[model samples]
Target: MRDRFLTGLIGYPIAHSAAPAMHEQAATALDAHCHYQLIEVAGAGRDDLRAMLEGVRRLGFAGVNVTFPYKEAVVDLLDELTPDARAIGAVNTIVVDGTRLVGHNTDATGFARAIAPLLATKSRGAIALIGAGGVGKAIAFALAGLGAGEIRIFDADAAKATELADQLQGGVAARSVATAVDGAAGLINATPVGMLPNRDTPVPDTLLHPAMWVADAVYSPLWTPLLSAANAKGATVLTGRDLAINAAADAFALFTGMTPPVAVMGNAFDAVMAARYSPSA
Candidate 1:
């Protein structure tokens, strides 16, 4: 039997990732022997990805999380994909069972859990979503699952938004808009505009109003400019921390084969956030 459960993350520029801390904390809370490592594959090609996956499997890693450019690229290399991963066209978590590598996506589940607390009020009307990439696709499907009435998607690459809209046409009353529409019940920023080192807002401040709810997927700073503006205007806001923490908890469960202590994982993430975003830091 394996004494230590080994897992890792495969991504470029992952030196600042908080996943290791969260998973390690979860391991302790569950009284398990787990070691989560980071395997940086910066600028890796398909052949490189194949090699890394092979090496990790041979090394007996339970699983690994994929991020950024490799999420979609790693799908074809997996032996099988979960239904959510297949529909979202991305895989964020890969589980190695014996010789079979199964791909799963926790982003959708995480996003759904993140927005759940607000759905009671936000699900009544239309939702304006920015960006239509991997995370965007997952959130779009999550919104449908949450019973959002209508979804308006906008991307700088107009075709991307249109394509996502077409995918959700029959399921949800979704359409592509040229820009952020006014008077929507909720607005979401799924782009990386407000991420660390970048303070730009994806949608203009004028598009935000006190009557709407706002959610940003960028959590490094926690209080993104978009969320800050929404807060100042009296709009209800949801930060990226909830999404990040919940997703990490779900991935930890997949890696260790144990029920995750979500509260402990959340507290661990809070500690990471405070340390990273503190004024003294």
Candidate 2:
């Protein structure tokens, strides 16, 4: 008999997340009666999130994915945290069992795995990362684990950038977009600057050279301005979709203990993208 269960994603302003469709499709392909939904917890604080956690377990949900402001805020509310999430000080995936809530940071591993194969022979080079938010921290730590030589973080909140740098025990150079891109072999955008409504780029196009490898964590628009500019400059580009695929793959393993059918998941994501953005779909 197939296992019947429930799983969902929890976040504020999560109408744009692809988690429900991706997870539901994966469960269907596996012949498992699993349902995934999106739970938007508005004005969600610790107590509010705890209520949702309790509700999911009571309702027999297998797990739930956490996103945005809650990634760090939910840490203290978790019953247990995986070492990786602990190391990065953030949690994007949470599994609830009875009274215990286990938190995991799959973004770090996911981004690393997604971009590893695409990186040039000089994978072990200095990288400049913009934005130091939840995802930014995960990506920074992921790059460090992937053997990146140096990571320089820049954020409007310099203290946040400095804090992330301190966690890496590496050089924390505070420089503007122009100065930060100097001699950097890789550039990563972990901020929301290039998302749908905000098409403006955090870094100048002039700073982007043909030699650098660029990756953006925002997947909403798919063709973010940052990625567009990087691509125009002939830099090897990694899209937000790439990160989504890898992160969803990791989440599949976490939510259901099986290797994900990546092809099916990819197709589903592409279909969703097409439906949302295609002019004549």
Candidate 3:
């Protein structure tokens, strides 16, 4: 028997999340009555969190996608953590089976899958990753797992970047801004610098080159200044929307326990982009 009425995403400031649209389209395609909603938990304290979990239990939601500040914070609240999530120290997807909430980290795997085809024919080279926060750490580990020749990290919080580097041991090198992009085959920005209302690129456009591949973890604007600069430089650009779609694919699988129709998910994502930037409905 097919499960009825499942899945949702939890986070603060979730008004912009594409999860509901993506999953709704998927559920529709699968002929499943599942519904996905955005549960805004901003300013929700510990008691509020408990109440929310209890409500999920009472409502029998199949799973929920967790994001941003709550990814780490929700770990302690979960009944169990998958090995991958435990290693990454973050969880972006959670499955509620019986009375147990199992946390899993799909961001790393999702990113690897999305970037693999792009790199399949190209030679692996050094990567300069900016931002050393949770998502940054996950991406760093994913890149290392992919066996990139070298990884360099830079962050305004030098110590935090260094800490991530140390965790990666010899796989990463901590570098200064001037030499950060030097000879790097790829550049990744995991910071919020280019997010909505903040149109600045974390790295200078002067540093971009045709030989480099640029990726930013900020997807809201879809066309971040960094991506624009990379494209102008003739570099291959990977936008955050790509990552979001890929991550949502993984989350969809976790929530439904079935392979998501990538084409359907892609269409839904494009629809979201259209609605978001469309001048008229």
Candidate 4:
């Protein structure tokens, strides 16, 4: 039996990634003995990213999770992209089939799974999104697929937001955070604003209201300032934990061709969060 697997994450500021622990733990539980490393590169350009992907291919790595600033940019560098990835215009998971690197977007699938239970009650009427990069693109497409009436996107880069909106057809580009959240039924943060070491939020707490449901894609803290304020304001809240774990499970399946033990991954994620919050390191 093939008993070894090598996979990893590739992105900058990925010290907060739970991919290694989650994947390794799930694999170890199945006696596969997986090794998931973190390839943290800062300010990598297209050429640098090209080199890294080549290194992964040369080093016999199973695959790697592309995150943050690289997901969309990595699309053009891959050999092929899955239908979902092409539709979302982003790639969060890359599956290596021999020499072929196939890009896939598990972010959309993961977020859909994470928020499915709440969709019946929460308003999918109009959503305000804080990022227009890869994750945001996946979420917008996912919501649209799930029958969202409208997606209002706002990014620090107006062009990016406009681009995403143009793609969505049902999407709108909001000029400011205030405009984005104005009468929004739900607010979601797809940026890195509230992640650890950067204890800030993209939107002010005043914008959150009891009538809104909120979600954040940042799981480093699990409880980001944006979700925190939303929770405090009596809004329905969805943490990034479920989305992270679910996406990772899907990515693991692509990496190892085995059904991931999702419960084990969930436990691993809980452990990572516990250690992060534990006072006695």
Candidate 5:
């Protein structure tokens, strides 16, 4: 039996990624030998992506997770994609099967899994989803799968939001909005705003209400400004940590064919967060 498996993540500005520790620790708990690496290809172009994909396979990597600026682009280079990934038009995880590379999007399922506990007994309603980028698209689909009745999308790039809404027409009543929809049942932030080094919230504080449920995709700090404001307003909140850990768990399963130790992965994630955000170096 092979004693070791190797995995990695490909992205620009991945210095803050918690995936490596989470997957590595999960592998340890499962009595498996695995090494997870960070392959930061900052400012990579089309030719660079192709080379990176070819290089990882040639180097015997089991798989790799793709992030920002590359998730959508990686799809064309892959031999196949999981159905959900195809529908979401993005690929965050890729598996290398010998010479064949397959793509999969765990973001949608991961977001769904993370929020399942919150919505188990609650009624589904209209969602105000901010951002229509890759992550936004994934969450929008996840919301549709959750049986959401309607979704209002707001993106700085109006055409992108319109395109996403048009694509989601059959699944959910999606519409591109000029601004955050007032009085929506839930508010989700899928953009990079409120992430580390950027303290801006996707929407203004006045838009938040106690009646709404709030979720953010920025998990590095765990307690983002948007989530904090939502919490102050007495809204039920889901931080980026919830999304990140769950997504990491799903990707780990894809890379290793094993059910990840969620508790272990969560702890590993917390450790990384602490080191990254601690007051003292």
Candidate 6:
């Protein structure tokens, strides 16, 4: 039996990541010996990523979670990919087995599980998805799988948006944020905007409406500027908490062949948030 496991997350600007607490707490609850690290490499290009992954392979690390700019880029570096990861054209978790590196996507599954309950009785109307990057692609695929009526995507990089739209049926690359959000029943901010140290919002406050539901992928601040604005407008809002906890649990399961207690993970997330948002914090 493996007595200890070394896993980590690879991405830049990961100082605000809440994954460690969630994974560590879940490990404690499951009696699993695990050490989750944060490997930050700023402005890492393809070759830089190749070297980092090689290090992960040579070091005997069990697995690592890929994030931000690398989620899509790391796909080509892996030895194998789960169908979902390949189909989604992105990956968030990579498991190292012997000499082979396998890529899997828990973000799509995690977002689906997190947002399904909220949209249970709601119509699968048009959705405005901000950011056509890796997380945006995962959210788009997840929403498509959930039977979304239509998905309008907007990214500053028009080519990226067009590329993703071309791959997904019923997806459109809108001209602007307004063009995408217009008449949409749901909205999601899948970008790094509105994260801690960045108070920016993907969409303008005036564009948000009471009839639509809003979701943001930024969890560190918990109540991001976008969610706070949507909340002020009486729109039903979903935080990144659910998605974070669910994704971490799924990734933990993949990293260690053990089921983590979601409740325990949630508690850890709550504790971290509480400390992060406290007056003195």
Best by lDDT: 6
Q: What lDDT tens digits, residue by residue, belong to model 1 across residues 129-158?
A: 998877788899889888887888888788
Cα lDDT tens digits for candidate 2, 75-192: 8888899999999999998886566789999899889988778664655666889988889899988888877777888888988888888898865455566666789988889887
Tell me how far candidate 3 lies from the true structure as C-alpha RMSD in angstroms: 2.0
Task: Pick out the ten consecutive residues of candidate 1 with the lowest summed lDDT.
Answer: 171-180
Residues 1-281, model 6: lDDT tens digits? 56577899999889888898888878888777788899999999999999999999999888999999899999999999998999999999999989889999999999999999988956677889998888999998998888877889899998888888888856555558998998889999999999879999989999999999999988979899999999999999999999999999999888888877999999999998998899999
Residue-pair clashes per candidate: 0, 0, 0, 0, 0, 0
Candidate 6: RMSD to truth:
1.1
**Candidate 1 vs candidate 6: which has greater lDDT?**
6
Candidate 6 residue spans exceeding 4 A from truth: 171-175
Q: TM-score for each prediction?
A: 0.93, 0.93, 0.91, 0.96, 0.94, 0.97
Q: Ten-residue segment with the worst summed lDDT in candidate 6?
A: 167-176
Worst 10 residues of 5 by lDDT: 171-180
Weakest lDDT window of 10 consecutive positions for candidate 2: 170-179
After superposition of all CA atoms, the RMSD between model 1 and the true structure is 1.9
Q: List the lowest-lDDT window of 10 residues for candidate 3.
A: 114-123
C-alpha displacement of 87 in model 4, angstroms? 2.1
TM-score result, candidate 1 = 0.93
Clash number for candidate 4? 0
Question: What's the CA error at residue 140 for candidate 2, in Å?
Answer: 1.1
Q: What are the Cα lDDT values of the candidates?
A: 0.84, 0.82, 0.82, 0.89, 0.85, 0.90
Q: Please, what are the lDDT tens digits per residue for candidate 4 over residues 51-162?
A: 9999888787889999988998899999999988998889999888889899999999999888778788765677898999999999888888888787889999989898
Against the true structure, what is every candidate's RMSD?
Answer: 1.9, 1.9, 2.0, 1.3, 1.7, 1.1
Residue 183, candidate 4: C-alpha displacement in angstroms: 1.1
